[model samples]
Target chain A: MGFWKTWFSTPESVSATKSAAFEEHTASTGDPSANSDRIVFSTERDIDLYELEELCDAVGWSRRPLRKVKKAIEHSFLVASMWQVRGNQRRLIGFARATSDHAFNATIWDVVVHPDFQGKGLGKALMKYVLKKLRSEEISNVTLFADPHVVDFYRTMGFMSDPEGIKGMFWYPH
Target chain B: MGFWKTWFSTPESVSATKSAAFEEHTASTGDPSANSDRIVFSTERDIDLYELEELCDAVGWSRRPLRKVKKAIEHSFLVASMWQVRGNQRRLIGFARATSDHAFNATIWDVVVHPDFQGKGLGKALMKYVLKKLRSEEISNVTLFADPHVVDFYRTMGFMSDPEGIKGMFWYPH
Candidate 1:
């Protein structure tokens, strides 16, 4: 691995080891909370509209019509939520939603970690939960758009800038 | 409107005019062909995998594993295909796909026009069809990643950069 990185070479062929490594990594780390916070992650898509709105407002995302907001949450293929459960009450703290064809490609969107739980790895945990779900469904090619400040954080989790010529674009009618 | 652009706005309340203008725009030009090319756009989610594969390959996007490619196409919420029909045969010349929660957000992906059909405005027409679908569904936040070179093309269609502090990120495990 050391020699391969320093020297120039063609991008290597798909290695048999990568699939095994990914499976092992996911299997070992699958459902465990990384630290003592006990932040539970849920893949249920039944999040309440008011709760979602509060999360977005807390993060300063633009306020949108409630119906539109609800559509975005319910239609996602993988909707992961991070929670802090005390006895019977579950407080929503982090969220990450993905839209994918459940096969070739998926894009992660609107990832938020409640301000109160920002320092913990809840966001990462939410993403990992989604990734594991996608993996089980055999989907690949996950993508997302983050604010530049958090780009480095996503990079730490295996995302990279567009390869060569590809770029990201969007239009907001507001 | 001009003053609103210059100052630090708390992101004012959603305006009524924007929605009216959007409705007018779509109502006026919604289904018409842009020019003499006679391109027809369809919002049908069913697509021919071989044709899609050929389009992706033409654009030199890394060839996705075949099953993943098939799944990506099947799962899109809105798949806008541009066709040039000649006497009962429909040719798939341009393609774009999106996945949205049909409410607050949608992301466009794998936009490609066959190299033979590149100069025409089919790409824009396909996008317009998609925007209309999203608009009718009441989805508001729409995003896509493009190469920096064509950012202007997307801009002309009303997409701006990462609003001030935002950035786009992705991960390709291949």
Candidate 2:
């Protein structure tokens, strides 16, 4: 509902949602504490490959060891979309990840907000960032799954019922 | 529909889809002249991890090396609803991985037919394989997002229409 801010200063960062992702070897890390705390707006960063693994671990998304994380970083940058409010480096408040051409469209999967940071409008703000990035790159479509409980939120964001009315699918190799 | 023969024979494969992949790395020597025509499904021992990689490469789905492949295999086995088909020494043909607890089910992904031996009914055969596995598991609810062009094929296979259509979503963290 409000204007979105750019994650990084570089123009390449604007349209490049996960550049290393398509190429395969990626590590994402971000400065979650940049803003530290301001409900209106905050600073965000790219969670490079290595940093992403740590965040995933902190959040218990995947039980991968640091060794594997190290090896994975060498191969493909982990593609994940994340946001930190008030610069909480100790935690990743809201996050998501998807694979895409960036120019065509984006698939937004796993929109999660940290337990302590929920209901503060951080999730929306982060997604707005993602949608804005995708749109800037000429991506007209931004798709995601809304847990039935929160379908209204996504609906407000412009996602509609699929022609089949079925929830989108996701798979975690790990 | 013709009856599909999907047998999950406990063939003793030397390389089982385990939880630890990279640790089980093996050297690869591609059969450059491998009968790129008809792949003779050999025993598990005959098809080392490397051979699996080769077959996956030749087919085009993906062979995420030992590390990543191990996780996928574990996930496949862990989910009470996996219909795996492995061949003799270094010979693996059609495969379809599904995730479900046997009640509400969805196969988020899979169908890796070796490229060299496609168009010979392997993909369809694999789908049949998946169907049989699901039915036997007593899983009546199976869902997935078939490409627009392929929706008809799924309908022909007995998958009903999606009353509420949904598209998958993703957003990579950078």
Candidate 3:
């Protein structure tokens, strides 16, 4: 079988490999503390849509249809979420996803951090973790569409606007 | 099964449905003439990578690894190509692919037409066919990253640069 057929034939193994790698990384860095306010990060896709929707709503992003949001999560190349853990309770605080060609290019989308979690460096850390994961998979070009106000935030993370004179264009059918 | 599972479970059927729809549309408009020059568009993914690479090279795009290209095509939601048909000979003259969430949004990539095939209306036809397919499936937001020189070309097709003040950003890890 070709690489494509082989890769798709066993998506579970692929996800397992990613999850294991992420868990190993977290283990080395120190797992989530049981009694602290530190936020724990996860690459698991089995996230709750209600919590995700609430996170988006908390940031003032217009309500996206939960059905469509679920579909997006199902098809994404990767999804990263951050949680504020206290004892056994966990609260979803950040979310982001990427759609990639799985080799040469990947574009990040729908990056959102709960309003309560903003300005605390958690957003930056979320981005860093996401980028690190993409880089580990050997994807070379990473791109994203950002709002005008947050352009500087991305700039601080080594992202340049319209690099090499490539501009993003959109079409909304009437 | 949920929509995502059902969708991915039968990708072949999805491609077949698209191919059948495209063929029906073409047949209704007018079939390609055997004695005259006419371009035929297809949504098939079983294309020869060498021909596609040649088409990309003809447009002066940098070389992309064929292995990676194959993987990209396998993962894409849609891949459209145009051919210059003359009897049994069909030459690949245009190509484009889209990666989507299967809802909400999609991004087009690797849109290229052979240099020799430019100036004709083939590129516009290719884009129209792609947009129609996406719309048929109810995707609302369509986007693409374009070279600065072709910004006006896309603008004429109702694509605005950075719509609603959403700027494109890139990160290239060193």
TM-score: which candidate is best?
A: 3
> What value does DockQ give for candidate 3?
0.62
* Docking quality category of candidate 1 according to DockQ thresholds: acceptable
Between prediction 1 and prediction 2, which has the larger lDDT? Answer: 1
TM-score of 2: 0.39
Which is superior by TM-score, 1 or 3?
3
lDDT of candidate 1 over B1-174, digit per residue (tens): 222232123232113323332343344445455222234555555566787778878888777777676666677777777665444466777788887776666788878888876654556666776787677766667888878778888888998766665667666654
Better of 1 and 3 by DockQ: 3
TM-score, chain B, predicted structure 1: 0.73
What does candidate 3 score on TM? 0.81
Error of 1 at B110 (Å): 2.1
Per-residue C-alpha lDDT of model 1 across residues A126-149, encoded as one tens digit per residue = 676777767767665787877788
> Could you tell which candidate, 2 or 3, scores higher by TM-score?
3
Best by DockQ: 3
Best of the candidates, lDDT: 3
Worst 10 residues of 1 chain B by lDDT: B5-14
DockQ comparison, 2 vs 3, better candidate: 3
Pitting candidate 1 against candidate 2, the one with the higher TM-score is 1
- In model 1, what lDDT does residue A59 have? 89
